[model samples]
Target: MVAIPQRTKGIEVTRADDATTTEDFRRQRIAEAAQRARAEAEARRAAADAGNPPRPREINGRDGPEPVRYGDWEVGGLATDF
Candidate 1:
């Protein structure tokens, strides 16, 4: 009969200092999202000032805004919520 090992090798234990709590992670994510939004807004404003309007973002696998469908109703093309 073959003998089995009691403990596995290379098992890593995370240190308390290296671990992030759920609350901390949530706050970090929120901050990142807000930063991205602000940056996009600033870019749009800059483009407008330069007389070059920002192109519509790709939606529904198309180059420009397409009609968004909600249940039986066809909503407006600009689907920003996605």
Candidate 2:
């Protein structure tokens, strides 16, 4: 049987190694892209939720900061009621 040349064998091995490295790099890029997309989606969802400011509710002609009920009542802010 005829034997392959040493140079050809070396080239083949090098090509196989390069292919594996290229595949690994491609996979890593895909994973990074997917992670970035997920982060962007979450950020967009958060931004959408934050887009519209909440309309303040008024009770007894009081503004947003003032709790409607002064007795153990609370709103978005800390409880000023005692």
Question: Best-fitting candidate, measured by lDDT?
Answer: 2
Candidate 2 TM-score, true structure as reference? 0.43
Worst 10 residues of 2 by lDDT: 4-13
Error of 2 at 27 (Å): 0.3
What digit string (tens of lDDT, one per residue) describes model 1 on residues 1-82?
3443332133232444423554466678789999999999999988888997666766555334343553322235543444
Q: Model 2, clash count?
A: 0
What lDDT is obtained when candidate 2 is compared to the true structure?
A: 0.63
Q: Taking the candidates one at a time, how many backbone clashes does each contain?
A: 0, 0
> Which residue ranges in model 1 land beyond 4 Å of their true spot?
1-20, 52-82
Residue pairs with backbone atoms closer than 3 Å in model 1 (clashes): none
Give the C-alpha lDDT of model 1: 0.57
